[model samples]
Target: MVPQNPGAAAAGRAAPVHYTHRQILEILSGLMIAMLTTMISTSVVGTALPTIVGDLGGQDQLSWVASASLLTMTASTPLWGKLSDILGRKLMFQSALVIFVLASVGAGLSQNIGQLIAARAFQGLGVGGVSALAQVILGDVVPPRERGRYSGYMGAVFGVATVAGPMLGGFIVDADGLGWRWCFYVCVPLAIISLVVMQKVLKLPKIKRDTRIDIFGAFTITGAATVVMLILTMGGKEFDWSSMWTYLLAAVAVVLVIGAVFAERAAREPILPPRLFRNPTFVLCSIASLAVGVAMFGAMIYLPQYLQIVKGMSPTRSGLMTLPMVAAMFVTSTGSGQVVTRLGRYKWFPVVGLALVASSMYLLSRLHVDSSKLVIGADIAVLGAGLGLTLQIMILAAQNAAAITDLAATTSGVSFFRNLGGAIGTAAFGAILNNRLTHHLTEGLAAAHVRPPAGGGTSLGTPDAVQHLPQPFKGIVLEAFTQSLQTVFLVGVPVALVGFVVVLFLKELPLRSSVSRVDQAPSTSPAPTDAPASTPATAPTPNTTA
Candidate 1:
């Protein structure tokens, strides 16, 4: 229906009228750069670890290399999202990009493992914003119907990064006079460019209303998350799982988490509005995302190792070998997104995707030393297709459920749980792999009647020293790695199964109208019975709350 007074609607506009195509591209470019930075840093380190550990000095810190980044990102995601709501997306995105760039430089220059880990932690904080806020900004710029196509673009960036990161990292690590440091250095300039692009192009109407940030709640949540993750990282590796120190730390973490809940409940402008939990669609999507994270990241982190150690490929070769999986993910993510947009229902995609992923994980669990490369590649591609379907679909589902007012928090909440699941999955899976590897290494050595090596276990610092060993010892180590990796895959199959179950329960909702429709409240709907009965034209559509 035509507005009786277009001037009144125009005058009541809360923010800028619209974004031009140039502006949208500019925002997307910055987001792509941010993702490129994250994927490169994550994948590059996997290939460079041997060289890095040789130079830096601790095998134990190897997991921390990745965990450091996950720790910071998982813990700080909500704060970044919440802060964007208060301070504006442009500021948060720019600040995060700058931090990541600076940290990358610091990481490249680091002389020791401690310094490197510290730098990675700082870098996580920066990239975390990009990871969480990119969706938030997209929620502002794109409607749920159109979002699937753009989300596909984001997935393609991720796939590109997975391929480029390891290949470039391997080349850099092996290059004359370059070494592993260049892996960290290469992404710094790109991050700087992303920051510049965001500053210039990411213009949107800010919430001009008064806002108060929940500083205490933010601190408690971060502190609590960090404490728990720290315990996970250290327990069973640095200290016994049953030790008093571990117990004490775990207790403190529980206390802090409880405190954080109460703080959030009472705070003004809480990081995660508790009400998001009340929506069944939001709750189911978040659960599915968490499980997907556990399955997705836990396997990706170890897939390259399976190729390099068990299959005995070089780092560069391993990177190339993993290409099919990444490529499949890119194709399926984009393809499934288009299908969902056209079909306007996402439930079937996740259900089918998780089932495929579960099947792939079961196939992966059956891998042994004699497994064919072609079969392995096919298995990985299956897993990737599952991932491609589930990961971004969950994000879009959450966005569709939320009202325009709570878009940032809703998108960020989905990301926050996915990352949290990843953090928990990576740590737990790493611990399980370590235990299984140790057990199998001892068993294999006993069966071969050979003495176990001094450093008989897998840790970040496990040297190429083993890489050069003779006879049954080398064979035994390879056996241990294969068995351990297979066990991890076995565990992941069940997790994916859980995701399948959860996705099955998710309700499909109609994709909402455009962002413009959300912004301009409709002037027609049924009036509340408690109020005076009104004609359709005089009634207003009910405002949606998160």
Candidate 2:
């Protein structure tokens, strides 16, 4: 056996300590709380948006409220990740929390849709930081083999927040004098608590580096994302598809993307490293992430509409009705993590998961106006299981496959693509819903020998509006909505199938058993001059916890 070094032991004791499982849990408590705050903030706003728009009187600006946040979030995600690597993770995370809380307060107090949209855009910066860094920090603290279990817990938190946000928002909206503003305010206390907890429990080693902010690259990418999102969000709804505005926006997006590629290539510390694109694992994972985002967000946004409009369920009831999906997702995500930790295998999970997502979407497409809630619940439960298995595992695979230096970039890259996909999917699917609804409504009204108003189906905004319409007109509108949503689900089926196909090509690597790659360092590196005479020159042994 090699002799221990007295001087080395002294230095080790003086150095910053690594975290134990208990300490990590303490840190995760803060992280999860922060994550929950972000999730709730985004989700809660959805149910309250109608009320907000009505109060603020900007029906034209309604979609911007969601689109603005998503646009900024996608654009800033990579920058946040790169910053964390250059600066310290903990400081960046806390900064993100403060920004989010302040923005939430601003949102709560907004007098117009413009102010609310602006506040949400600012809030997206904070959200971008938190979402990217949360995953990065997990990679920092936990070894790959053990990270799966913690990922499951995070997924469960995500699932719970998703279901609860709408329910809570609906309750607050219907409650006397609570109003839509409280939807934004409720997240404030939770965020404050998260910030305090993180300050107390989180301790990470700070690495000082020369920071080079990619200002031009940041601008180009943000512009590109904004343009793309605008085209998607406004092309069909705000402007005719054949209009010059659509073509102009699309052209501008293409140019910005090209410029961003060139800019990133020359930057000292690129926001998204071009080298990552060369990695097959990163590329495949990004594609799958994009497809998953498209599928998941499309369903999440449209299904609630189906429940509220077709079934005439209240927002609270619609949120509660989604419990079956959330519960199944929670169970599967948690269970899959434990299984991955135990077996050290994960490729099968996503492969099977995507298959289920495709199947669920197909099943949902078959629903009609008279379809029972039980059937709807069963279909969505399948979707939840698929999402649980696929979503977190992609991040794990990307993290495991990335170089140590590229960890944060990889995490944020995956997130960026997912957000991009969601934005595009939501907009594209929304356009589809609008177009199909108009066509069906026109046909149904004409068939019923009823004349549509002069604007021709322009007044149909929410399910609540449709619900109040007289007898046969309401029935016709409900049928149109049902058929339109079915088309949306049918479109989603192919997107999920693409993800399923892509996941099949993913090459799984053995999960790492340590936080760093020190064990894998070359054995030829010279030892320190002050080393003990009897010290071993071999590489450090890896932890074999499993």
Candidate 3:
């Protein structure tokens, strides 16, 4: 009979149970669906933001619509990971789903920007949980050797949802009688479905451990992250880079981070163990994840702007134009995962992936106002292939290198760096775009003897502003936008190269074939018939078989 106690095997009284392919797939279906709902919630809201802000009469608070979610999501990711390690994955994941669905409903029903922002911030907490726990659960269920095969599917789901979210959001926003509220409402049903499926199918051994919650460490890290995110989101836009406000915020961020480090060291159960940083593989992987985030998010934030402003594509068309990149990412991610699983080697994937990313960024840097759509698609596809190769592989490596007990924390740590990098990259790149565009616009307008409007070059970023300008002035503005975007792409090239270089130093660890810790002694007793059949937790093996 299935053991009454799920933790029995984990406690070493019985053999660790292994899931069959069918069972694994059944579990994965729920996990992926849950993951897709989170991704869609973020993406679907993106295109609707302008409409939502207009309806809510909060033009000044526009950025907070997105920033609210991002800040809380990044800050809470590590906490969720560590919590799952202390508690159980299934409960944490379900809780996240429920929170997300409730928040979505609240967001949909909001009467003002304040309410919407608060709801979105709450949604971010859930998103953080779902994102961290999903990977942690994967680490718990799948052996490192076989994880690649499934990771490919997870990556593809992420890529697809990202691409589709905007498209669906735009459609909903433009449809008569539907409006932007439906964007939030749409996620509720899907989320409920995911919750029900997960509740029924997800079953994992719960490890009951005596561990103290690192309350002080959690506060410090959350404070540090919030400070950093605020600085990134507000530095160039809300305050001048050289302003005292900027300096004060930066100083506060640094001080908080230092405080977090000290707090972590003294905690009985650190949110992020100090030992993780000491592991060379974890360090390299974290760096690589950070670099990838910088390049990927930096580029993604601006691509639609380029298409819509420079090419004059409609929002729907702009979303459609990114299909090549998404398609290439899906294909490459799935294929690479299979290759990694079969060969039992992963180091080369990121090496080659980063190389492609660098090459694509450099190529994109050369685009001009007259660049062909085919050329743009080809450049982005290359970058997509690079992303597909690197993102999951790095996380897999980190999971493999970590001790079984650290699985959740390690997974979350890797995610934390990536999110941190994305925030920094998006902010830095936005500043670059603003600065370069302004400079180009001023020079071009002066050369044409055309006086800029009251806001000078500040208004040029708006498509409507540029479209209404006199002939020569409009052309000049378009060229400035094109040049600024090219520079942004050029900046991404070096960041991608940094990731490539970091990957080269990553120490390759043998992929373990069993779900359990290598140190855990194997039990010879047959698995209880009712218990799931699990491969014994054994030491790493050389076997390459899938």
Clashes in each model (backbone N, CA, C under 3 Å)? 1, 0, 6
Q: Lowest summed lDDT over 10 consecutive residues: which window, candidate 2? A: 537-546
Q: Cα RMSD (Å) per model?
A: 5.3, 6.1, 6.5
Encode model 1's per-residue lDDT on 408-466: one tens digit a residue. Answer: 87888888888888888877777778778878877987898878556544343333555
Q: Give the TM-score of candidate 3.
A: 0.88
Q: What would the TM-scores of all predictions be?
A: 0.90, 0.90, 0.88
Cα lDDT for residue 55, candidate 3? 72
**Which 10 successive residues of model 1 have the least lDDT summed?**
537-546
Candidate 1 stretches with Cα past 4 Å from truth are 1-13, 20-23, 453-463, 516-546
Better candidate by TM-score, 2 or 3:
2
lDDT of 1 at 159: 83
Runs in model 3 deviating more than 4 A are 1-15, 46-64, 109-117, 453-457, 460-470, 520-546
Candidate 3 has its poorest 10 consecutive residues by lDDT at 537-546
Clashing pairs in model 1, backbone N/Cα/C closer than 3 A: 59-461
Give the alpha-carbon lDDT of every model. 0.78, 0.81, 0.79
